[model samples]
Target: MALKSEQARVLRRRVLGGLIRNLLLFSGAFALACLAIETFMVPSIANWVADSTSSWRTLNSSEQFQQILTDQGLLDDANLFDLWVNEAVEGGYTNDAGTITEIQGEVNEMEDALAEYASMMADSPENAEAAAAHAKERAEKLGADVAVASGTNAAAIGDASTFIDDATALDAETDNARAVPLLPYQTILTAEAIPTDDASAAQAIAALRVSASLQELGLSLPEAQTFMPPETTVDAATRILVSAAVLGYDQPTLNDLLQSAFRQSQEQAYSAWLDLTSAEEARALGVSDENPVWQIQYGEDGVYRMRDVATYTFVKSFKLPLALLVFVAGWLAIILRALNRSLRYFDELSGAVGRLLADKDAPIELPADLSIARNELAVIRSQSLADERAAHAAEQRKNELVAYLAHDIRTPLTSVLGYLDLLRETTDLPRETLRKYANIAYSKAERLESLINEFFEITRYNLSAIPIERETVGVRLFCQQVAEAFFPEAAARNIRITVDAAGAGQFFIDPDKLARALGNVLRNAVAYADANSVIAIAARQDARTTTITVANRGREISDAHLETIFEKFYREDRARSSKKGGAGLGLAIAREIVVAHHGDIEAASERGVTVFTLRIPTQGEEIEGAAAAPRIPGATEGVQRPVEPVPPRTVRPASTRATSAPPSATARRGPSARPIPQRPVGERTQAPRQGTSPLNPRNARHGQVPARKTVRDNDATPRRRGLSR
Candidate 1:
């Protein structure tokens, strides 16, 4: 089954979608848990605790307390009211005493002012009545202000003069009152109260003196109230008794009586209040305690408090367990679902790999599902199958190579032995016959040698990297030498070979290695090129690269063969029996050499013409001690060699030309032969053939070729052969 493309895309989307969805789910779960804790669980717990505890001694029933819980939620609002109540209760009664003290102080100041004004009026009887009246009005106004501070009615100011007289008499009577011990009462009053401008100092002093007098008599609250003056109103007597109690004058006894009475009254009032607001009663009031709301706490001190104790305590008790349960359940479901989908695919892949490993010939079987195509296991399976196929093909090639080598070597060995045996057995044969046998033997031996060398060459290339012994060589001269060496062979085959070395430059190369590599290409060209056809050899150079091309008009190589033509043991002639085909190692060896020098070689064939191109770097890597070599003449220093002059070519048919001029520095063929242009060294030039000239006449007219000294070849070293693959 074929893999589905849409399925693969869908699988990717599903994977990413699953990841994102799971992340959101987990995040959402956590956020919900937090929200529940903050909004519901925490508040519920706080409300429950508040309802359960006593708020009568604290402030759970206060308006501020209820508002805090309603506004801030239960957890933050907890215990807030208790804090406020404690503060208020500690200072409440003492504040009242301070108010009284302030009012009395203001009244005393008014009396002193009035007394001073009256004395001034007495100095002048005519001004006496006016002064007295002014003083009285001033006194009345001051008394009214004092009355407001004391929490007394403004009507009390009507008797300001009389009140002043009584105050003075009281002050006189209290002169000896200071001698009495009242340290405990004073300390209690100071702690409870801080006198302020609003309080009546005169009233506070009177209350203090009364309390002191009562303590000296060791009277109870009732006994002190009874001793109050007859003219004193019930309100005045009650204030005296309360102040005495606050100042620690018979404090323990008075506190017990007051608490008992207060408790009795508060218990009745609170019971009635609670009944009115009970859950049953709340429904009638349109207030539902569907959640049983606040607990009622009534204290011994007659304080009533209520708190919410059900909602928070019940919620806090179960929120975490519920949240945890939900989280675990969700995660488990996700894990199980993921495993259900993935585990089977993984298991199947593992089994397939195991089978393949166990039996080398076993075919790999993978799921057709495109969802699994991008999985690691699937990739490994695919690669393993491909490697197995490649290994099988390679083994078949190796078997064919061994058989071909055996036959090729045997044929040459048999010929050489047979020729030598003929010479040995025919002693009476003619000299020419003897010579013929010897020559045959020698030729066979050479063939055998060439075959052996080919095997060695393959082994050498395969064994390790090929090292280059580099030297500076004139590229143009090198091409000339190669062409000259092949001239005799080409003449024998009725084929013409031409060399074009226009604008070729000096290059650093391993001369022997390069020669061998070039020989392989030339040998292939010579073997396959049609008889009487031109095989063109061209060499040129540019700034960085030196290019050499061997082109011939011959059988066109197929595109498939052209790609693998340089592969070891690969031959276009699949028969492996062609006499000229030497084990198909020649071009492969050439490629190895060129590649080792960090260069490239390629082959292309079109319209019965095959061309092999080699491009090696001109400024190749230098070996140690090779930098100081003398430069070639007519070769530019640190630059490409200039194009040499091209002598006119003599065109002739293939049959008419017996000898060719020691081919020109830039050679071409036929009537179209012209001076080849000088191009920058390392520049790539097209492959040369019958009709193509490197030079353009228009370019030559423009003086593209620079005038320079002609280079002459002076080295007369004899040419060596047997380098061709």
Candidate 2:
């Protein structure tokens, strides 16, 4: 957890690298947007409209658009309506040219649709045959000249109307896609109806004109008629086109009629404006009906803000520039937003560190742009949790071992001191009685010595001293030797030991250390296996590796205890008696030995049957009864053992101290044993009485000291015992 100064510089460099990369990315996109505006928008604005000329379109400072509109105080005046009207006329509001353009476009679209539909005759044979016949007859028209038919309109308009009606009825009988909608060309019925008002008449005429175009029936303006001041009769409205059916004008079309319509619609307004203006004003502000100004919503409050012509000329005339302005603005906005989010991702990482260490268990989430960062943070959080759990478990194990050591030390010291006191007093006792007290004190002293040695093991064991010594050994022979070592012990309980390694070939391993490892495992089986139940040792080999499985019928190991059984000083049954079990280093040392052989060991239990598996990798050096690998001198294999012992204090019976035992001698358990009384350190406990020892069940909780007995020099040799604590 300690941090160093060098890491800060490294972190800053990483931050700078990411920041520079993102900025360069945004810079590239900005450059592309600028280039697009220049290529596609600049030229379009330079010559905005096709009609623009150098004479009318000046870009000099003196003729800048801002200066042009402000030169004549035009924007200072409120009378901008005349300009607005002139512009309105240009857009076909009071003229028919714009309407004609719209009509031509719509007609073209309908023509294309109709042609494609009619050509589908191959797909619709019956309808195609009838339509083809009618088309053929019309194409061969005899003497119906279009121009001649229209010129005789004043005299023969009624006959023309009848001819169109008859032609339409015959055409309808054919029932084809070529039949244009009658709503556009029903002039035969139109004479009976006329729009009643000027507004209605104008709209009706517009609709009828469009219909005629769709029908491909060419028409001309109606002849003028006399009208009263209060009302303009429909039949007298010259602005309405004369139906080609009513005038026989469908035969010939005149382009000039459209132009005349445009002029007639705006001439009255221009003439009225001319009469109101003087010669001086007309020269500066006059507008022609032919070249109408662009329309303006002059009543709008801010037209003069950009100068009178800014909206009228600048924005309306130069569309690409406005679009370019918006495109560039939006492009910059998007780039900057993403850049900001990139920075936020870094902040999220910083914040995630705190949450990973805190109580938050949720997975770190981010937008799609930060998916990689999100995934990495999630992985870090998981690893942090795993590390935290391992640390917690290790701490718990250390605390438990300290407690066990304290209890083991206190229990034996109490019994040893109690028996020694019994031997010191009561000198008049029988010889056998003296021997019993002496024997009990000597056994306790030996156990206390064994425990102190293991306490040294906790601090002094070094796993690196013993190197792996490879040897090729038959799996069956190797396992049988291990199991055979425990046969006498197993026979005491009538339990059977069996080895089945039929196909298990030779594998590489350390003979001495592996023998110690397998010895540790078999000892546990012989200790915990149910009396009279079979213990099975099986080994198998494949091309890659060899496996040895030791199975025994015993109490099923709980999941919690199974996980920590391989941890140092961890035993499944947690017994503290020196006569019953070791310091719980057997399985841990076994795992170390197996791992050094480039292999692993695992334990599992189900249905009262516990199994320990040992697997060794065959990829290392080949071996045949090989020599031991070089190792540190005085080093013990499988587990560590102190070379020397700590001398007892002068106040105690130092001459009675027992010799230290090897670790392999530590984990063996007996058939049955009493539990040790556990207590915390620093507690003030009274000296135990000779008749009320803490280990004796008969004494229970009574701690009264025994009456002092008669004194005597009771010098007696005590019986020695095995070194197991």
Candidate 3:
């Protein structure tokens, strides 16, 4: 239980440690990822925002105008005004040749009128004096009118010529301006041909006003009309003259008018270009009027240009999210690897446990990396092996017990069968001989009965604790009485028996159980004791214990055998020869009985003497009523006849009836000279009388012994014997 608890604690600690380690690792990785994003990615995006804002702030109005011109492709090296004029002519916005033709025709008409007036004056001279006065007046009026009209026409023609020359010069200037790729806003002023030399700001303003008026009038003309009505034409000419007078010439006004016309055309063209180019398309080309990154800067040439100043870096677009993705993937992989390892560990452990449970004999194997200190598998495996060994040992002991019982029972049975067979076959035998065979057979039968009873005693001892009948028994007297039962057998072997009970007192024990225990010890002593050697039985007591020592001069038991002498089925004679040794249960049974009385038994042997000591705890509490003590079959009760030892080589004279022998004969021949009586062939023996010793001379002398008639002396046996002979 303690081992299992410790293993559980170790397992918990290992699991907790793994969890903490994984958590720390994940946290550390996440922190590093965040740090990288902050350190590298953040600055890049911030710089892009700052540059974009600065780029937008740098643009001015002139730069914006140039940017629009550049986008429309109008600022190219080609002559912009010439191209405009060509486009205007194709679309019929102006008719320059028709205007020149109209002016020439007007001059011709003035000349024709002056010639007609001269002819009228010459032809009218015939009307003489009366008509002279009228003609002269009309002539003067006509001439004056012709002169005025001619002068006005000639002035208009000169103005027209001047306007044409100025336009040609203005066109040349526009062509020059268009020659440079980056023309300035001031270039447009040059294209207008406006003379700034010696011009006052006020005079320039007046010139601008007159030029704006002329441009408006030209724009209002219908393309299909080559000439205006006479009144309208006259008014237009008067205005031109008035603008020229105010500005001192028409050239400045013409320059202003041209500049205005150029601007209007440029704006219209720029609007068309804007409509075709989307903001997104403009950014793709690296020049955006909308995006702040596409900034415009003014040069010393007074020209405006666009350039890209700021560009987005890769870090701003990709690094942070990419780093985050990498971190997540790495963390997931680590987690999966840990999960796989844990799963494999559990699989191995589960498989080992399953196989072990299926077959207890199977070997337990675990993963190599499993920690021996923390794992319980090793401990469990060792315990299983120990249990298996213990089970095997128990099985071996059981087999040995069965074999020993079989051999012991057979020994007594053989003798009984031998004697009984002899009686059945012999014909005309003497009555004494028949009685002798019968007596021998009966003694052998009793021995067999005793051997069988030992088996039962062994079974009872193993099943549970034997109920002990506690009583006050005289220790000295009990030992003496038990010793007396073995005297005849000891005497038959020429072995001496002695009892010593000095300092012994009445002991609280189970009397019948103690007697049985002592009988077993005494029987063993007699069987193995050498002839003429002494067997001693002594009882001693202390304040707490009563000790009985039974010692015999016999074959010395080895030190190894002595320790196991009281174990069931252990014997000094391993061969288990029935004539020389018992079934090895006697001492074991004795030990059981002693233990049931709260006592212990031990054995020792040295110097050719073997001794068994039985110690009972006399001071312990005694049980009041115990179950009836087990009766050992064939155990002597009243007047027990001592078992006689077999001679080395001797046949009995068959007439000895030991039970019927007189007390004087028994006393003279020694106690074993007579046999105990046997029952008749069909009759059962009566219950043995209690409290009467079979060896008592009084009972034998008074004829209190149960008797049986000799079978060989009967008439029926003789008749049967005669027929057999």
Candidate 4:
């Protein structure tokens, strides 16, 4: 299927456009779900999609982390380092800002604690007082702090209905510059000297400030912790416990320290496991439990050291991409199916074209989508069928013409036979009687011969009806000769004939066939011209064609008859007898020969003048109808022809049928298409009557001894030799 044809091009473009549109639409929808619409989801579906597929990675990482720990003899039931590190690192998420702040806080606290502990260990009285004053200042600061707000949900900030008016403001942000308060003046922070024996003394010094602050709020320690500043998790808790025990801590304080130490130990072990792989090792290895492309999976190597995304990467999911592929593939299949179905309409067209000549009456049908092509095909079929019906009608008319011609031949033949028999039987007949008998017999024989010739013309009206040989001819001479050929018959009726070939110099045409065509027209005109009426023959030429017209003055042919006058076997008056009526093929055959040169003929009658016009193209083309499949033994039955109420009633159709030349003086040189009013059938045809019918012996001008004579065919075809132009 070439894309050049209309149907193929239409379907191809449509299918391609559909596919492109579908792809673009699908892509847009996918992008909307991923970029625009997904943001409104509660969990942020990206997080869901991004995190949901992490289970396998998590398991793999946990195993790999454990393997390293086990290799280092650090993996034990009590430690469970992998779990510790996973939580501490917040599901292994990088925490660049949090890590910096955590390490800073630890450093600040260690500095203060060590300074106080060193002063107490110095055992100097002033150093101890200064330390006591410092502790008193810290307690006073703690006491001035606001009490912890009460609430179960941390987001509510201690009250379920707590309004966050500032947060709603567009420019809202944290107040990073908190004011550091000065200590309030105290009358006495030291009620007595510090006790040396009690293990609670150290704790008392450290805890009393926070405890006193809590008592001021009348809240328990845990409750006060909400308002208190947050502390980072301390590492090496066991060392802190050992040092505190050596400083004389009792069972209760020791128990608290032991518990804190136990939990911190687990965290410390995790920190140690991650520390096993240094920054160097981290960059080199492609581990099993890593991000896609062996990116860092767990906390740095195995330890829980917070880092940024630029350093540590995570795993990815393929689900969304896979789903997109399936979506596009399925749509592609649907597009193919739709396009495939459209091509089936062409199949319907093929079948419909094949059935154009079938003997069926049903209309060809197609899908609504193919309406344009369908309607056009329907028109073609209608024309073909109409031509078929007309052909049949033409065939029927041919048979009728044959029967009528036979009858006509019989009339003349019987007369001739009867006249001859009378002459043969009467031995002593009078000289004048014998002369009359001979004249009658000769006339009948002539009529019979004319009828036989007409029949022969009809038989030639088929696929190979006539062949043409084109040549240049003198238009003036041609028109003059054709007009002069009818002078005899024209004179017999006192009808004058004129030729107008002005500006019609030489023209290219088929001389013989074109002459015959012109002769037929002139003959018809002469036979029907009014007595003393003028028959004018005109020939002219333009750039492309040569035009000739023969006009006679007589009774008018009705518009109805004019339409069909050029069809096969069409008679103006069928009742006209052998002597006056034609088989009706003269004008029709004239038209055929003219059309063969790629031109046309037309007739018009108005007032009392009837005219027949012929046009022949300067550049001839083949007449397609002439060489068409031979008709069913095609005879121009209306021998001669009619347009069969066909040819759109526009003069005539281009057909392959020919016409028979009946013994028609009516076909002679006549403008008579309508019948003479109430005239007898065989009466001397008047008011457009036959003049000196070459068929009727009484009407023919026979020769005297010294007179030169002219003989002509029925249609005035110039068979005369040595004829002067």
Candidate 5:
């Protein structure tokens, strides 16, 4: 394809690609925004719900039941019940105390008899009968006391084993009194029992109390006997009746049966109370009780019912911290996922770019399976890659354009230089000599035109201009023609030029462009050669390529200049020495041409020899056998120089032929692009070697003439003055 066309495509793609990339980046940013919303918004609501559920404790089934029971009137008779209990208790206490006093008096009498017996035993050492007799009397008195206590108290002292701590601690007067369970419920039971009169009810209560005391105290038969009154012996019939009443067996009094039933009820109630209290205590202590609530039932019939209560069990749901954790966790996950995906996309992009840079020819393949492609990150990456490709292509095209310009321009310019040289050498008559000078003037003008053209070409490449044009050509003829064409200039400076070839033949190239490329190398050699120095030009071709070198003998250039010698407008001798030449565009143009042909050129200077070598690919062929045919050997030599047609008026414009001769010391120094400092005209007192300093540009302008330097005295200094333009 044409370089200009390719360059246009490259620029368009670059601009469009940039716009697309920007759009992709925007899309990626939007994806990131969505992720942010997910991370921050939804979980806050969930947390609010969780926090509000934690404060109040709910009631269980048992507690609710207890409340219902409290609303009923079953427990309202307590006051009346207490009143009845007090009256009954007073009468019982009085009767019991009277009986106890009688028993005590009898016991006291027995104690006296016992004391007397002890004294008799001590006095009657010889009379054991006296001691025995006193003891018998004490025994009879004790028996009488027990009978009396029992008969009066109206309660049987069942047996000695039945005695309790309270019964023993009481005085003899109070010992016979009835004992009842100390509880508020006792009053309720008492009041509920109907009595015709207060006294009768009191007697009934006293009997019931006596029965309760006998059973709870566990009084034995022997103990009962001691408390009995003196004349109240407990005979078989009386014993039977007492036994039946106390034990609540056969023939028991109504009060006795009620007391037994009451005792049983109290015991059952106590057991229930213990169980309920234990369960409550466990729950209070933070232990899990099977039943955490208490149930209580009160019946008008004096029945109290208790049961294990039910508990409401549930997990504490309203944890502020946990709720906050859920909210934060959910948001954090979203944020992390978003950030992670972004980072992953960046990583992939970086890798892809690295690989593309390493190998531009390879196609870009990305891993977009991570949901990144569906997101904005993918778009950004794709855009970036597209931009990169466009830039790469544009850059490539620009370089190729530079190459095409340099090669094409140099081709015509070389022919013009050669023709001017031929015209100068062949003409001798006065009019013809002056006319050819005009021709030489035209040649120099063409040279400047070529230079300007190459300059713009390079500038365009640097700014990303047109693409390259390439083709194949024979290497042998290309190298020979370029070398031979510079032969006249070499001879003018007494510099010998040689061409050596080997191996390969043809090269893939644009011939006109390549010829100009080779010309630049020769030009540099001619400008830099020392007087009588051999400027060797050699060409070699291998399976892969051909290398043509133009070398000159001169002072070597420094490493710094050698590196940048091919740069544009690089003139080695800027301060016109005695042998200055053209503007510094030769090497630069040469380098561009070589590149356009898909070749390369390099410069090296060492040991007084500066060499510029151009390497271009070639097809297989013998080297040196074929040499470039010289510009149709001079017209007089029988070398049938065909008559050339005159150029059309439009083709040969007068303005194109106007130019001044080259300056004197236009030396291509070492392998440098920058011009080297030259010896001033005043300093040229010493003779310059043959090829080192050519004729002065001023002298050449006036007439073709040369001069030899003259040295005066040892310390003589020449007067310095600027040369004429």
Candidate 6:
């Protein structure tokens, strides 16, 4: 019951955690979207509105009008004033400046007209004659008539309210500005005269009077000028009032006059500004000069309209909010993209971890698509991939080690079993038989021990559990000594061991390990070799490395076995361990020792010959000696050369037996690896005595031969040798 409760609690916790994670992920996504809209999208719309020319102009006008009201000391009740300003600025005073500009342009047009007249008259072809005639005429009767018309117009201006007050003040204060002279009665009456016999003269006189009055108006006055009209009509009074308001007079009916002007001007202004017709027509027309007058008349209505347009102020007001929105939204997109990448990374990581758990030794390869992932996630992915690779390499190494161990352990056991069987059945055999079986068993066991030591040595080397002891030894002496050690064993079986010295000095190496490796090779050569056959050990050195070769006579190794021959229990003959008594681990141990010394070992085999080569770094001086003498000088040559040894691992070869069978036939109980010539059973009936073959009489026997010719059949090998019964 307690365990069940615990399991349920764990399951609940997992479910809650998953729910929380999912909730957070969705919440983050929604929050990011909201931020994008609030921070960037809304502001972008506001900015677009603010940048519109009509909107911008509306905003500017409202701002200016508000300032005008403030400067006019009209902002007493702030809220009320704001409301009033909004109404007045938007609806009424919106285009006041535009109207002022138009009026100013009218004055400019008048000036331009006057200038054009002067330029045209001055540049005329008959200017001198025309000017004289016109002046004469003006100085006569026409000049008087022009003066009378000027007098009348001056009288009207004197009564006008815009000029009357100031003109009256100036006349009262300045002696030079005493009443502006009223035109004579004759000038006024001349304007009404009908054209008769002197029609041209009358028209010229009227033109002169208008020109003269305009000249007087252009003159600089002291402070004011005064005049009195002959009479004032209602139309004239209204005109006076309207004109006075345009010049900024405060009086009754002023607002009415301004309203009328505003109505007319705004109609024209809207058409031009909005391009109500085609753009070309709009360009040709403009706002009326009287727009401000009309706006002032409309009062609150116009101001409110303008103020409404200006409220875009809110859109442009806060700089930071808009920028903040954009910044937040853009960064949110980047973050979300990064999150997606992280999720992908988690997926890849999960896969890699699963592969690791399953102990897959194959490399875990990542897709190149990872380049699109976030940088940090990419790095994490890369590290995971690297870790997978490392794990795979370790796994492969472990498999190789296991295979090596199994091979090493089984080889010696097979040899031991084979020899034990031989010993049990050979109780009444010859002394040589007892000696041969005993020596072969001993050698096999020794090989097995060496293999065990090699495995330990390799483990220690990799683990750094043991330190190598380096000592100097004479190279020549070391080689000779190791060779002599194996000489007795070789002589026991009538085999010959030889050494060739290529140097004359001392060198450095782990003497013990080197000797063991060399001994294993020599012992192997002796066991597999023929009686009276020679095994040679030779050494040489170049600038970089010292080479030691062990050459031996035998059947050639197949190409398939050359690559793995140094591996533990990797025998050329599949049944070499079982039939001939070997652990098949000698070369493996030798290879390990050489590698520990930072050297290399290789094997090359050809027809009936095999060479095991070892190369190590050369020491300061090479060994000094004559060519080594053969331990057994009278030994006969075999089909192939011998393997050599170097430094402290040199050894002589033990004697071994070789025999041949007739071609095309098979037998057991002989050297499993011997390159024996075999013959068919049918053909052998006509052959000479079996015990009298020139190759070796012992090999020709039917019963058990001497130890020197002992052979054994091997598994996987057919009836290739006929030396055994």
lDDT of 6 by residue, 1-725 (tens): 34454433544454445555665675677668767877888777765664452221111132232233234332222322123223323322332322333333322333333334334344652232333233333334221211221222332221222211232332233222112222221232232232222323223322233332322232211111111111223222222322231233332233444344334444444444445333332232332222211111223333212212133455456646766676566556655655665566558756765665565443454444433233434444455555455445434544554465568767876888898898897688887676777666655665565455445544432332111244677666766777787776677767777777555355577676666667666676776776677777777656655666666677655544553455443445543233343334456556555554556555555445555556555652322321111112232434222113222211223333211211221221111221111111111010011121122211122112111110111111111111100
In model 1, what is the error at residue 309, expressed in angstroms? 12
Positional deviation of 545 in candidate 1, in angstroms?
A: 3.7
For candidate 4, write residues 1-725 as lDDT tens digits: 46655655666666677667877777777667656544586246545543454321211123333343334333333333223223323322223322323333322332353345234524542343344344334423433121111111111221212211122221122112111111110100111122322212222222222222211122222321221112311222222222232233333444443344333443554454456554423332322333332223433223232222321223224545665786777677767766676667668877777765474476777776566667777766665565556556656666777788888888889999999999999999998778778766766676786787666556544323344567888888988877666676666667788877777777788776777778777777776778888887777776676767777778777654554565556667656466556666676666656655556566666667666666676555433222221122333433322121100000111121112222345433243121101111111100112122122111111111111111111121111111000
Q: Count the backbone clashes (under 3 Å) in each candidate.
A: 32, 3, 9, 27, 37, 55
Local distance difference test, each candidate? 0.50, 0.46, 0.47, 0.46, 0.42, 0.41
Task: Encode model 5's per-residue lDDT on 1-725: one tens digit a residue.
Answer: 44454433543454446445655655566557646754896356433433343222211222222222223221232322233235445534333323433334443453354345335534543333443344444445344312112222333332212112122223333332322222121222233442322323333343334333332233333333322222223342123223333333322232343334333454444454456566564453343655454344554433444433332112224444555575556555555655565566557767766766676555556553433323333454454555455445434544543454455456656666676676668666576566556566555454545455445434432332112234566666766777766666676667777766655477766555566667666776676778778877666666766777666787766554553355443444434332243334455545544553445565656557666666665642222322111111222333221111111011223343333343323221111121111111111111111122342211111111222121111212222211111
The true-versus-predicted C-alpha distance at residue 261 of model 3, in Å, is 38
TM-scores, each model vs. reference:
0.45, 0.40, 0.40, 0.50, 0.39, 0.37
Between candidates 1 and 5, the TM-score winner: 1
lDDT value, residue 440 of candidate 1 = 61
Poorest 10 consecutive residues by lDDT, candidate 6: 680-689
lDDT of 5 at 707: 24
Candidate 4 positional error at 472, Å? 1.4
Candidate 1 clashes: the total is 32
What lDDT score goes with residue 665 in model 6? 16
Using TM-score as the yardstick, the better of models 3 and 4 is 4
TM-score of 2: 0.40
Say which prediction, candidate 1 or candidate 2, comes out ahead on TM-score. Answer: 1
Query: Lowest-lDDT window of 10 residues in candidate 1?
Result: 708-717
CA shift of 312, model 6, Å: 6.1
Q: Tell me how far the alpha carbon of residue 709 in candidate 6 is from the true structure, in angstroms, after superposition.
A: 34
**Model 6 collision count:** 55
| Candidate achieving the largest TM-score | 4
Question: Poorest 10 consecutive residues of model 5 by lDDT?
Answer: 641-650
